[model samples]
Target: MATSNGFGPRALRYLESARNLVGCAGGAVGLGLHFAGLGGVWWPGVVAGLYGVGALLTPAPKPRPPLPPRPEPRPEPQPLPPEVSAPPAPKPEPVPAPEPAPAPDPELVALAAYLDTVPLPPSAGVDGLLAALRAAGPGPVAERIVRHRLPVAVAGYLRARTWQPWAGPDDPDPAVQLGREVDRLAGELA
Candidate 1:
C-alpha cells in the first residue's frame, strides 16, 4: 500500500541501489588515494565526500494531496397530486360564519324539560323513543332527534348512567332512548 509517511517499494529499491554504488565508488577512490601516498585519514574524507554526493542524489518523496470534499445531498422535492395543490379549498369559506346559531325555540325547551322529568331507561331503542316523542307533540323534533341525536345520546347515556335499566339482549328500551335523544337534539336547538 502507498503511504504518505515515506517512499514505497520502487523508491526504496532505487535508494538501496544508489547507496551501494556510492559505497563501492568510495572504496575504490580510498584505495587509489592510499596507493598515491594519501594517508588513512584522507581515505575517510573520500568516503565522507561520496556519502554527501549520495545524499544529494536521493530524490525527496512527494507530498500526498488532501482528500476531496464530500458532496452535499440535495433534498428531493415530492410531486404533489393536483387535488392536494389546489390552495386548500379556500378554508371552506369560513363556514358561512355559522349564522350565529339560532336561539333555542321555547317549545323545544318545554319539550326537553318534560322529557328530563320522565323516568326512562338508558338503552331504549330508537323506535319506542320516537313513539313517545310523537305522543308528546314533538313529532318534527322527534324525527330530527331520531335522525341525528338519538343514537349518539343513547350510546352516551348508556355509558354514563349508573342504572342498568331496560338494556336487553334482543332489543334496547325505546322510551329511555327517546328521552336521551330529545336531550341531545335540544342541546343543538339551544
Candidate 2:
C-alpha cells in the first residue's frame, strides 16, 4: 500500500535499508548541482543533515518474533513384556595421557622468536636451524650456531629494524646476510 507520500511500503523499506548510503549520494549530487548554479552553497550540507535527521526520526524496524520450534514426532511406547530387560551399555575406553614434549634449547627458542618477528622467509629462519642440527648432530656446529651465528642474526635483525649510524654504507641487507649466514651454517654442519 502506498503511504500518503505515494511510496509503497516495499519502496520505503528499500530506502530505509541503506539510509546512510542514500544520504551521502544525495549530498554529493546536491553539491554538484550547487556548483552548477542550481542551489545555495548550503544545499549539500542541508541535504546530508536532512537525511541524518530523517534517519534519526524514523522508527526502528520491528524485530520479528522467533519461529516456534517444531515438535519432534515421538514413537508411541509399546508395553514391555514382564520378562524382558534392556542390556547394560558397554564401559568407555580410557584415553591415554599425552606425552610431554622435550624442552626446547634456550638459544633455539630465542632465535625462533626473533625470526618469527622478522620478515625473513622460512628456509632462512628456524628451518635452517633445524636443518643444521640434523646435519651436524649438534656437536661443534650447534655450538657455533648457538653461540655465534644466532646472536649475530638476531643483532642484525634488530639493527635492520632501527636506524644504524655505524653500519657501513656497503653492508648487505640484513635479511640477505641472515639467509647467507644460515646457509653457510647448514653447509658447514653438513
Candidate 3:
C-alpha cells in the first residue's frame, strides 16, 4: 500500500478505477482461508470483507473525451464601392425682406405733439392729461391722443415736469423736450 502524502501518479490512477481489484483479491483469499477452517485468521478475513464492500460502494470516476481542434477563422468581406456618386443637394431660395411699416397718421402725430405742451399739477397723473385733452375740445385727434396709452418714461417725465415751477425763458421747455420725443417716435413709424 502507498504511504499517506507520498502517492505516485500510478497510485492516483489506481484509486480512480471503478473497481478495487486489490481489495477484491484480499477478500477472496480471506474467504478461502475461512472456508479451509484456518485458525486465528477470522479478524483479517472480516477486515478484508468490509474493505471490499466499501470499495464496491464507492462511485466510479467518469472518463473525459479529448476536445476537437478549433477551426481557422474566415477572412472579413470587403465593402463594395458605391455604384455612382449621389447628385448634389439643391440650394435654398433667398427670402425677401419685409416691407417697411406704413407711416403713422398725421393727425395722431400732430395731437401727440400738441399734448406734449400741456402743463398740469403733479397730482394730475395720466388721468389729468386725459382730462386736459377732453377739456381742450372734442375732436377726433384729441380723442385719439387721450385714448392712447403713454409710455412709462414719457408719463413719468410729464408728471415730474408738473412738479417743477415755471422755468426762465432761457431754460429748455419741458413741452419742447416732450415734443422732440414724439417727433422721434413719429419718424421711426415713417
Candidate 4:
C-alpha cells in the first residue's frame, strides 16, 4: 500500500518480522536474548544483534474518528495478605564489647620464669612450679597469685614457724608444701 511512511507492504512486513534478521530461528534467538537481557547478561544481546534478531516492531495504528469517552469503573478493594498483616520481626540486640584482659605482674612473671630453674629439695620432684610456670606462662592468674596471694601465704607460713619451732609432725613440711603448691598452681594455670 502506498502510505506516507513510504514503506511498501513487503518492507512493512520485513520491519515487523525483524526476527529473521539473521535468518531462520530468529524468534527463538530473540527470546533467548530477551531473557539474557533481563538477567543482566549482554552476550546474548550481542549474539542476537549479530544473528539479525530483534524485538518485533508494532505497526502504526490506522487513523479513525474519535469516539465518546466511557464512564469510569470503580476498582474492587483487595484484602491484605496474611504476611502483609503480620508484625515485623524484632531487631537484634546490640552485642556487648568484651572486657580487655588485665595485665600480668612483672615481678611475679620474672620470678615464675626463674623459679623452674631454681634449686629446691630433692623430694620436690621435677619442680611443679616451674612446669606450671612454663605451662601457664606468666599470665594474669600467675601474676595475681604471685603478686597478691603468694607473699601472704609465705608470710603466714613463716610466722607460724617462728612462733612454734617444735619440728612437730603436725607442722607443714616445706618440701610437702612445695609439691602441693605445684599441683594447685598447675590446676589453676591449666
- Taken over the whole model, the C-alpha lDDT of each candidate is 0.58, 0.67, 0.58, 0.59
Error at 122, model 2, angstroms: 4.1
Candidate number that wins on TM-score, 1 or 3: 3
lDDT of 1: 0.58
User: Model 4: per-residue lDDT, tens digit, 83-181?
Assistant: 788677899999998986645546756655655465555564435554455556566887776665555544554455566556777777765675565
Per-prediction TM-score to the true structure, in the order listed: 0.22, 0.35, 0.23, 0.32
TM-score head-to-head 1 vs 4, winner? 4
Model 1: runs farther than 4 Å from truth?
1-41, 57-59, 85-190
- Pairs that clash in candidate 2: none
Clashing pairs in 3: none
For model 3, the stretches where C-alpha displacement exceeds 4 angstroms are 1-7, 16-41, 65-71, 76-190
Give candidate 2 misplaced runs (Cα > 4 Å).
1-106, 122-126, 134-136, 164-171
In candidate 1, what residue range of length 10 has the lowest lDDT sum? 122-131
Q: Return whichever of 3 and 4 wins on lDDT.
A: 4
Give candidate 3's TM-score: 0.23
Q: Write the residue-wise lDDT of candidate 2 on 1-190 in tens digits.
A: 6457555766777665755555556667666777888778777576677567655665666789999999999999996776785766799999998986645566666665765676655545657666556445446768787778767776876677565456688866666767787777767767
Write model 3 residue lDDT over 6-85, tens digit each, in one string: 55766887765656765566567666666777726466757577568767776766768889989999999765557665
